[model samples]
Target: MKGKEKIKVGITIGDLNGIGGEIILKTFEDNRMLDFCTPVIFASVKTISYLKKHFKFNLNFNGINTIDKIVHGKINVFNAWNEKYNIEFGKENLKSGELSIKSLKEAVKYLKSGDIDALVTAPINKHNIQSEEFKFPGHTDYLAQELEGNSLMFMVTDTLKVGLLTDHVPVNDVTKHISEKLIKNKLDIINLSLKQDFKVRKPKIAVLGINPHTGDNGVIGKEDDEILRPALSKIREKGMLVFGPYAADSFFGSNNYKNFDAIIASYHDQGLIPFKTLSFGNGVNFTAGLSKVRTSPDHGTAYEIAGKGEADENSFKQAVFTAIKIFKNRKEYKNLTKNPLKPKQKKI
Candidate 1:
């Protein structure tokens, strides 16, 4: 899946005031980086210029009014907005948030039209990028609404893959979100993603407990022993390579995540805290179970280092690479399964 074809990855300028433009420019500065995929950034020409000048980045871009003019081996900037806006670095304003959504909406338009193979979104301030037009918790929900099927926020690195069962919810509200049906459905999505998107045959999944020490046999909390255990049993009965209601506290500390292909966390922080600590500035957040491929840097908008030229672009680069890899993997998987070896009338 490495060099099958050059994929067109459409990028969104998350927040004009944040490090979105900086990382995008940094990642595409290396001419050798265009070997596997062509990048089309959905942003205004003025905005790109502002970032390039402010950061003192040595780079060039191809400007186009539409996706039809996208060219390979060069950074293509598709004009998502024409109006000039202020580049207030390290400050959040309504205009910056509005433009971020504009960029995102334009990128999604091309993505749905099949002009781009996958999408690589830059970091956005969840609070600022909120309005009547965009009223979701984050990119995961927004993309899910645009594309078909469910969406899972899967954080990936070299050694660990973590999926959250409950995303962007309060700690007190986490327990209400957990149920046998929900767990089973998420497990189904994870299993299929491993096979099709990741090419992991016979994938092993590790399920985490909601409570500390896995409830200590109903001492610490009954949700782990009662809710999580039953869900795991039912999931295994369905012929999945799954195990454990492992105690979340000691799971990463003891390095138990290395044994499985993916880990399912009951909530957000349980999985991400460890993943961020381990991968830091290089992890990619992939949205699984959607028809369109979407990925982003695991970290969010770092306002402190917005225009200081100190923001790291490794994670953004990984997001682009990961999107291309998944696109190729899905294509290869589709061709392999287009026809079965056995006759259609034959029963196994």
Candidate 2:
């Protein structure tokens, strides 16, 4: 429950064997979660029941069998399916993976139908969840394909935001994917998302080059001068506040990352390695360029600490809060565009 007037968010529980169920229980510990948005979760009643027994979370909840009858208490659950099975905590199994992915797909239906404002996904392990029923590398790619958005994978924390140009690719193949067009497309997604989705007035983006020492001006590699720098010029011409081809190794030192609103990296590790180092436990992964808002925790399913009541729920909490906040901002942004908002300050 998010709105005093109506529901605001639809949450999906990820793999049950992982800490998804535990975090969902812990993250919604605040009574204020109900006030921010109506949360319709796509999960199983059986899984929910199991967690309540182990965790002993005392909240008024409704296990809804169908979407039409969902009502809020402390939590509202819409069962994606009605199957019940015993699951071992801190362990990976194929059935739990299938259940998690099904829940995600079912949640997307509500998103597409406008039944929910935004979605906050709990952690799911990609390796375990890659069976025939669930073939996605992760939620970001799955949501991109489903929503048909030209999207970039953005890992956001309180202080830093990193957008990947080529995600889930090997280091050897990273340079091959770094091109003028690819960088522009990723930047376009990041820039537009900053405006319409996040309400950033003018976003300054930093682009990292593709090699160590930023290619050392062709001493190490020419990809920096030959490729990335040219892309920066084109992005600037479009009236965006973007810079860099910043050095790959030194960019994260001494608060240098705070200089820009967002950093667009040449590849996956180029961006994530540093970001995880800084905000590993607190980061949130936001999928940019989708029509609907979607965010997930930055870290994956921590199987080691899944069931001991030891998994920190901060990132999960952040993911949920980020979705709810962005939902309101996007609404305001849409309202501004629809009514063509008057300028707040007059020209001097």
Candidate 3:
């Protein structure tokens, strides 16, 4: 029951202008991909063909108009994007963004319907996608809305993991969003994700400060001592192991990040800047608190490197593997909780 033996991951091509198409095509380049699990891409045939032809990738694709005709050896594309894409690398426009959003919407349907086990999204341009059909700030919010409002964004790498209490918000608005209720809710989501999705029994997390030197015990800002500390104390009192309102400036450098399972940052850059600096190309952006397992590559639409075959598929591969891993963990955890005393069998 381990590995990718029983899972179906749905992939949504983010922005054709970025490295989304390139990495998707490159990821499926291996003929042995079928050995893992079935990959169902919710993307356009034309766009994928554009990537394959432009990048000179020779992978078999099962281009079908609907979901029923999916099979292996050829990738099953769900035809989420119908429009003929312009496919300009390093360019941002409404058309590409809308198309990316369209794929996301369709993929959600399959995920909710149990047609797909999880979702692996490629990178998208947040700026261009804010218009019209793209009403929400980004995929995290959009997925939250789709799931009826319960989703958290988590950036994960090998060495470090950081979850946001508030994401994609301006510096001014960040303080406004940090409340006791919001902090507790976000912490619950992180704790559940660590156990259910990440397969951790007990998760230890570090809560970061809103100011330098953790408010210097109120010399700088009272938010860390008054707001963050009380919140962390309440969370610890609830039996979850969490600590600090640690100094934002020195947290990444202290090697204390390794002590915790995840870091809960006050703002976007407070956590993401360090996460990105340490894990630029290999990080995975996972949507926790969702009914379905969802993960995406951490980097955004690199339009400058699009269609050049220079885009690395490692992150996309990581996203895919992470989805499969979560899917397995969900299945196994469910089994264990249901029947913990069932005889443990060693593979002999």
RMSD (CA, Å), each prediction: 2.9, 2.5, 3.8
What's the lDDT for all of these models?
Answer: 0.89, 0.83, 0.84
Model 1 lDDT tens row, 263-289:
999999999999999887789999999
Model 2 lDDT vs. the true structure?
A: 0.83
Write down the TM-score of every candidate: 0.95, 0.94, 0.93
Off by over 4 Å in 3: 1-6, 342-348
Error of 2 at 174 (Å): 0.8
Weakest ten-residue segment in model 2 by summed lDDT: 1-10
- Superpose all Cα atoms of candidate 2 onto the true structure and report the RMSD in Å to 1 decimal: 2.5
Q: What's the TM for model 3?
A: 0.93
Candidate 1 worst ten-residue window by lDDT: 1-10
Looking at model 3, the pairs that clash are 90-303
Per-residue error at 119 for model 3, in Å? 0.7
lDDT of 3 by residue, 4-44 (tens): 34467899999878888888878888866767778888888
